[model samples]
Target: MATPTVEKFLLEVSRVLRERNGPQLQDILVIEPPLPPLYNLMVNELRNAFPSGQDDALEDKCTRALPEYVEMEDGSSWTAFIKFMRQYFCFLRDVNVENLVETFQLLRNLVKQSVNALGHGSMGVVLLPTVIAFSRALTKLTIALHKKPQLIAHLIRRQAADESGSRSTLVDTAADVLRDAFSGCLNDRSVTGAGVGSDGRPMGKKISIYVIANLCLKLYFECDKIRSAEQIFVNIQNGSPPLSLYPASQRVTYLYYLGRYYFVNNHFYRAQLALQSAYDGCHSKCVQQRSRILPFLITACMTLGRFPSQALLRRPEAAGLAEKFLPICRAISRGDLATFRSFFGPEGPHTDYFLRRRLLLPLRDRCEVLVWRSMARKTFLLAGSQGDPGARKAPTFDLHDLLRLTQVLERRSFGQTQKKPIGKTHTNSIFMFQNSQQNGIKPELYVDPDVKGVAEPAGPPEPTMLDIESMVSSLIYQGFLGGFISHRQLRFAIRGAKEKGSLNAGFPNVWEVIKSRSSDAVPGWKRDEVSSVRNGVSRPPGPGMVIHLSGARPAGTPPM
Candidate 1:
């Protein structure tokens, strides 16, 4: 049977709605079935409208189509379809299983139409509703996925699922198709074209890219398709119009999702930078949105092996969440695995929330590493406390103790219920965790030291000496642990360093505002008000990372 077109289907819908108000109308009958076909038809129209490889023809086609859109369709059916679309597309209406697939297809089609129907920049303002629609869809869909894994199967069949349960790549679908459409059109914007704006950008192009990127990220994050999201972001970052052209809100949102993508992949430093950008630009009105970014921001720091220097979480507004994280911060800093587990375990306030987003494990790595590194640190400290004035802190950690430590960390930190040691000692004595795809610790167990816990080298009449050196190497490489491993002595040297001479960039204004009329009851050297003001002003302060984006200051910046 041939599928009916939405325009033809809308004739009946208009009649039904005309009789009874839309409130009583079944969404399935009026809004769902015809949508997929409409989307396909619109895409076909866009493919024909926005031709590729012909710069001259592309411009001519866009100009010609502008007039057609203004006067092309029947007033009754198409208008109603688009009006209902405006509501559904902008997330003003509800969508159910019957219509969800069609809704995504509709969103993709709307973008395709918007991208191709370019004219004056201001005229393109209507395109933003499509982005808003997409944002809501992605948020809802991602949440739904936790409840319904196959939610988007009707619209985009995920071929990523396999016997080995890991999502590596998504099957080619609407997201990729939209990407191709956008890429093909972007190919035609002349580098030196007259469309360049007062801000030295191509008119009508930057805003479209801004809107499109936000949607692309939702596909990656919400749709559970990592490679597609990465592809879209890389494309934008490398060559597309500058994202900064978008408003602060859009920029913040894009960077936030981008940061999350980076976070999951163990790219903590880059994730920190992107998330920091989001947090910095976040305004007071969007506290809920800002709150969403906060836990991830803190996660980025923990992964990097430290708590942020700034009192970000201690702010009056942020204290609620920060108070909970404070225990975690102290636990990880001191390498207290027992306490760390209690703070982030099942009953912890933030654990379940962060776990829902797949963020807690990333946070746990640093804690694991901290526990192991702290052991090594104590070994060095104990040795250094010997009678010799020049005694270096050295690893005297016993072989069985190391094994016991590793076993406990594996079970506790990883939720690894497997009651066995992960590896045997090599002849060179390097302790390597067996890369078990079965256990899914191939990366987190060995390559990533921040993932936590230590694998110890067990010695025997067996040719292998304990391989403590290799395990320590991995930890130091990722910045989770400090000092080098001594292969000759078969010990991990513990050299603890501190961030001495660090200046607090976030508190300069607070110091300036301090109107201390003598010290309030504290015994102190009472300095003149003028002297205090001069000291505060003469500190040679520098600009810090944007507000709320607390991290170690970039190196080579003069101390504030």
Candidate 2:
């Protein structure tokens, strides 16, 4: 009783649906009238062709009718239709009552057709919706059939290889696709009727998460975009506490990527926390996964300045983590190259050479302490030009020499060893002092150092008491004092100073100066001012002046 045009359209749609050629179905169904009967007939044919065993046929009829009013001429309309077919295919794929896997090849053809339509720009208006739909359907199919991850991974890689436009534009398109797919999975709530689960939870949630995680990682690798991955992870972390997932292995995988995301962003503190949690969640027997994550965990700990356990440090598994990284301390110490190379495996020689060339060599030259030593060596060479061979001491500014000095100093001051290289700026200042001593520069030790004499021909003098006070005042003027120093830091520095006399002797004073200036309450600075004045004038402060200032202050005012 149907018109020939109607029958011909029905036959083509039937062929596409039977073939599971969703893309072809999309093309044939693009121009259909918004008629309930037409939709109902199509639904009847599909259901009869692929039956769900306890079906109220009317439910299919109503579900199919919902797509009738959706237009396909505009992007929004096309998006909607794509969404519909996506869900439709997902429902077909997941319905346990049906044998959809046998028909998946046919469905793949339609998926291919839809992709081709998108490429041709005929489906531009609905490209996003179509993408979302296809992803949802693909996710459902994978979950229902227990498909391997490589299949989806291959599809994503192929799409990324298109090479069609500016790099930024291509990345943006890929990002949009991932974003839409993520949105679809989060919004989908039709699990019960689709036979996915009885509790209205889609069987696809885990698979969806897996696919999105891999896709996000691919996006990060290919395009270097991370926001999508970050959002997906944040959502997962906030939506459910990971421990609730029975197969903790899958959840740990998510945590791995989450930690990696933070690590790549240079958020080592957070990366350490997340990676540690992942390691804790894994079974004790899963040594391979633990081996895979150990290096990242160690790197995070190193970056955060946390000392890793000796067990982790000595484990053969730790070699992978230590191998590529050239820790500043280790490189400076010139630890065993063979040990270092063992981490890089067969590429050890090449990697070791590059590491020495690019990092160790440049670092040695630019680092301040070494710079001071080099200058001292030059000065000693020049001084000997007048023929005083007996006056020369062996050059004593090697890495071991510095390490021994730092260890001794740290032990005397802090009662504990520092576990990492000190900042280059601070280390350089100490090196200069050592070089001055070695070169017989006779650095004047005075109670009140003169400020002007501190200036070198090379550059301005290091900061004096007055200069530090003024700098603090400037920072306070800009309202940056509160941000730079906290009350606790001030207390710690003060406590540290009382235990070690003349805290002003080293870089610790720099921290103190910044702290005192930023504090709401001022600090006593008689010693600092006296040291500065004495150094600048190359003379000692008389006892009478100290007594006069001590007597001049009011009851509670700090001496300055």
Candidate 3:
């Protein structure tokens, strides 16, 4: 009952499998939505012959219609491929109708059979290319389903009861599919040695781990289920070989997500390490990706008190970022509390941008301490009397001086965000009633004692001495300041001014303090390991190879 074209296609698939041709099998099993002409023709033939209203009958129909189907041969080993192919055809038919419920079900089966093909001996390894192709198709469909929330709800309702009775999205289901594939690749025992594949090229199905993982990570993040991605990192770190063995693009992307994960968990130092590696390894031509990374990188550096340079801000990838970050950086450097609040506060121009990126709250909280440290530094410079160089007592500034500065900055900050009355200009409103009352006379303005007696509405509580004291004490405790506060005298004195210079002793460098407290190694980042074998040969660099150039002149150095 098979059409001539369908029969020829099935026979060609069987021939490719028999020959163990991975690339050919991949082409024959193309499964991205809107199937290829060959696949479309096959599905159309099957639909005409055996139509199922809403059931899984492709197998039954194939069994009856094509009894000579190649997989039906006794002792045949192409079972998984045939199953995956049928499911893929069904998926393409249903996808056009937007039958998400049915399409997801088919996707689940396709993932299962693909993973099975990976586990089935050397033949499975030959199918690795096909598995990768299927994974690409899977990632697209999964992400597409995730973007439509209404379909997720509909799929949930029409599907069977859940064991956990909790809600789930199609992307989460796809993650399980991808995770199974990832585990299959991770546990691939066919690797001849560490980081080397079976066919002797530093390659194998294990090379597919990050490919699947990066896809799964994409889904988790898109679904706002980032915490669920922790196991992916844990598994790779505990068992997978050095990440440098992988391609650079994969390393950059994985590190990017890893950095973002650290950022969300409040590990700013670790976040900087991961993001810095990602940004450096990323190709210069990848402008959009580098741009995606810069905001987080820039923010992380700012948290550690290292501001972006003019050259960095001028990079093509950093376009529009200067408008967003430069003002805050200037405020932090200049101790301009009013400017900081105007830009980061609720009425700030970039508030929407910051909030959209989830940066508003963290920036407001963390960088305020840096601002206070700057303010304290400025206060010492302006008001403190530098005692004699040989004086035993350290240089000190009165708390009252800091208090006055704090009050002025706080009031100025409050004034910048004040809202004016909605409708009238001052002159138009103050004289409008006069013109209406006396046709053409300009009414003399008089102050009303009753109105004056009513106190003006209070602004933000002026920064009190207690607030300033507590803030200075915090800066000292956090190691941003190398000083201590005196309770009785209400003054802050540098601890080592007699031995170390006043400026050096009073304010410790922010980056150095942070770096000292953190470990040097970053989890899941591999920088040194290199693969020893490729394609069954040991190919070390030749002696004359221009590998390391320690003697090379640095950029911008004048040549002698």
Candidate 4:
């Protein structure tokens, strides 16, 4: 005999089954316990019925709500979903919440069952909502696992499902399950069902690819398994529809991860493109989302010599970012190496901030090159011969002149700190100033700027002649300087200064130089021209070019 509460639950399930209401059915069959009185009622019913072996009677009523087989096509999805829900009920009743590892595996198998149904006739429409729900459950499982760091060792061992002979973590295995789900959506063959839309795009279940993909990416990044994320990007570029067809939320999330992938591989140009699109497409009201995108976007922009403006830093999303990046900008602009190193060095105040984002070494290395260019340009402007037509000569500056300017900047940047310590303890200044103040007299101190003829200071060593030459050569080689180093004269001279003026002939714009060398196409980014069919092959979308082989060897030749 069924209890009144058990009978009422079964009646509701039957009603949902008859009306084909997936969301309501999903709500009823949640793996976790329901809220408030329902939770207490379900727990009490399970506790009282299980020990007496009367639970089988209640289970029978749950089973009878949906029959084993339905002759009608409309009942197929319903039948599949109800079967999954019954398993959810069993898990909720029996699962040990304390053992999250075991609990995660149970939920994983349940979601895997849902993943399998994604391929059955038209069941994807019915099971996808549950699939996303279970996946979130798995996410919570991983988060819980992260809190217990000691238990991570247990997760580090290879599971029976992983055949690669390498260890896996809780998040890694969850990503694999989600990858399988993503594949089910990507590989759907149904025409009118969930495969392609009327506009010739991935529709229905296929639209869930990015949703599942974003989940997998989140896990992969957390577990330090970035290489695995690349394969997902490749699959989307090959088969998925243009990203614009998806909702704004999905597009923003996918592009953010894609931009980060490019960034880790040192592809700043591509990183900037993806991140810029993500930032622009994101909703203006989503402050947290915009905040997450700005760090990588700012780093990429700075690498390409485009600094963020003051107005941009004043936005709510950019709070505290100015303190970390502003010093670097001012250092680059003023060509101050000491200030740059003082703020961003290994022992600097902002070191931990940049280190956490993995931006420390890259910013330190790549931005230093721009600093050299600034120093060189400043030296030329101050000392190089002016390109007045009356002079009729190329603009030239001595290497010694640049060396002097660099030393002056370094000394000034570090001078105050070097003198502060000694002044705090020294006798002459403190005694003399205190006596004069007691007598109501003011003391004035002045020193000539040209007093120091030697390069002695309490900081980094001065740049040598060889270092200056190498920096100039590098700038010239990279096309930042439209000039050549005159080794014999130990000077840098612009090629067409007499005709085009010094600034035009000697220094090129940093953005233009970097832009000309960068490729326009980023592999996973979507554009207007990409086709649904992609001409029967998967290739990067953009203008195609050919490579010429030099010194080709004949086929099957064995000699070296």
Which candidate number has the best TM-score?
Answer: 3
Off by over 4 Å in 4: 1-20, 33-36, 39-65, 68-83, 157-165, 192-196, 199-202, 387-392, 404-463, 496-500, 530-560
Model 3, stretches more than 4 Å misplaced? 53-78, 97-102, 151-164, 197-202, 420-457, 526-560
Top-scoring candidate (lDDT): 3
Candidate 4 residue 106 C-alpha distance from true site, Å: 2.5
Query: Each candidate's root-mean-square deviation in Å?
Result: 16.2, 22.9, 12.0, 11.5
TM-score for all models, in order of appearance: 0.52, 0.36, 0.80, 0.77
lDDT (CA) per prediction: 0.50, 0.42, 0.77, 0.76
Could you give candidate 1's per-residue lDDT for residues 53-170 as a string of tens digits? 3334433332332333334444312222333333332321233345555455455454444334322222223333433344344445434443464665632344443556554322
- Per-residue CA lDDT of model 4 for 202-266, tens digit only, reads 66677788888888887777667777899899988777767777888999999999999998998
Model 2 gets an lDDT of: 0.42
Higher lDDT: candidate 1 or 3?
3
Ranking by lDDT: 3, 4, 1, 2
Error (Å) of candidate 1 at residue 165 is 20
Candidate 4 global TM-score: 0.77
Q: How well is each residue in 1-560 modelled by candidate 3, as lDDT tens digits?
A: 65666567666766786687988888777666566677777777767764656334665543433344334445555555556556655655555436765666776777777787678645667778877777766777777777786777756775557666666566777788888888888888776555565543346677777877888788788778899989998888766766777889988999999888888777888898999989999988999999998999888888888889889999999999998999999899889998898887666889889988877776777898899999988999999867666656778888899899889998998888776333344566654573443645434544466796677668877888899989998888888999888889998988888777888889989988889888967675544443455678976874223465777898999988
